[model samples]
Target: MKKLSFLFIIFILIHSSVSAIDRRTEQFSTEFGYLTLPLPYVIPGAGMGLGFLGGFNNVPFGST
Candidate 1:
């Protein structure tokens, strides 16, 4: 019984700790002009990127 309880506690701790890390990619791209507004209460965290544009034609050279 003690061993089972210890294993359960360990499992819970591991799961919780693993989920604290953000597993999202660091970069993204959009083909069309758009805007992104994150939630007011949730500040954007590290390991993230953002971009804006008005239209595809206005994009600088060498960008596709």
Candidate 2:
């Protein structure tokens, strides 16, 4: 696991450095909501999950 994590980090570093990123980004973590009104497939009030558009990989060129 440690080796995998290390390699992943290295890969991300190389990839980020090789590419460019725009500074524009959404600042808030929006909660994903579904309208399950009288739906047979989905239960009422059953939250599916959070809409986590993970910005961890959104590192700019200088950040790496």
Candidate 3:
């Protein structure tokens, strides 16, 4: 069961790391970006939990 849970977590990380957006017309001149990743995991005793990992780049200095 522990091994299965670990594999599942690895799968989720691998799949989510891929970006599906097309950056053909997008310009990365400004330093404004945000990324929110889903945090899901299962423990032997703690069962399952869902959380999130997020961040903002140049949020204080970069203008919208």
Candidate 4:
């Protein structure tokens, strides 16, 4: 679990740096943004669980 967490953090850092570069090289647009939705629920016997739905809108470079 610890190793997984560490890797996830590293991945996020690298991805953020790449995204920053992409944003810098692109034309400024008001439609670019991200959304995150959290979902929490309970089950009859399985206890509780949480989930997230996230995405970026109008990504630069015509990429979805």
Q: For every model shown, what is its TM-score relative to the native structure?
A: 0.33, 0.30, 0.44, 0.41
lDDT of 2 by residue, 33-58 (tens): 44433333444698454343322433
The clash count for each model shown is: 0, 0, 0, 0
Candidate 1, lDDT over the whole model: 0.62
Off by over 4 Å in 3: 1-28, 61-64
Residues 5-55, model 3: lDDT tens digits:
999999999888885867786475455789999999999998999999998
Candidate 2, TM-score vs. the true structure?
0.30
Model 4 regions more than 4 Å off? 1-30, 62-64
Top model by TM-score, which number? 3
lDDT of 2 at 9: 100
**Model 4: per-residue lDDT, tens digit, 1-64?**
9999999999999998887444655485657799999989999999999999899976678655
Clashing pairs in 2: none
lDDT for model 3 comes to: 0.84
Candidate 2 displacement at residue 48 in angstroms? 89
Ranked candidates (lDDT, high to low)? 4, 3, 1, 2
**Which candidate tops lDDT?**
4
The window of 10 residues in a row where model 1 has the poorest summed lDDT is: 51-60
